[model samples]
Target: MRTKEAGAAMDSEFHVQCPYCGEELDIYLEPDVQGTLIQDCEVCCNPWKVEVWWDGDERSVAVSRGDGSE
Candidate 1:
């Protein structure tokens, strides 16, 4: 992931596959935002649970069903 300056917010981009739709998607999130959030799949309109975490300088992301189930 790379952080970009988006106006006053620092944005980070990640490529993730939609759990339900199985489509690749580019997701933008403010670097300051942490933890899990719900995002709708652009290709399938299904809700997705997006998890963001950082380990030191490394960034990580996980995606699953919006209902918090595998």
Candidate 2:
């Protein structure tokens, strides 16, 4: 029998932190999204307003923060 794989090859969620409270949070990565992906904090419940710029050629993500409120 073929065993099931626990972790997938590509992770849908990326690790992040809250800009307001500095709390750890997870941001989902859309498969089709090849640009900035804004994210919010779950623990602190704050709007981080993140920006993830991804290079289509290099296939990399550069995360940043925007105007957000706690």
Best by lDDT: 1
Per-candidate TM equals: 0.77, 0.52
> Residue 37 error for model 1, in Å?
0.4
lDDT, each prediction = 0.81, 0.54
- Report the lDDT tens digits of candidate 1 across residue range 2-21: 45444325337888999996
Can you write out model 2's per-residue Cα lDDT over 1-70, one digit (the tens) per residue?
Answer: 4444323216456676666677666667664565554555666554555554545532344444555333
Cα lDDT for residue 49, model 1?
A: 88
Model 2 misplaced regions, further than 4 Å: 1-11, 34-38, 56-70
Error of 2 at 48 (Å): 1.4
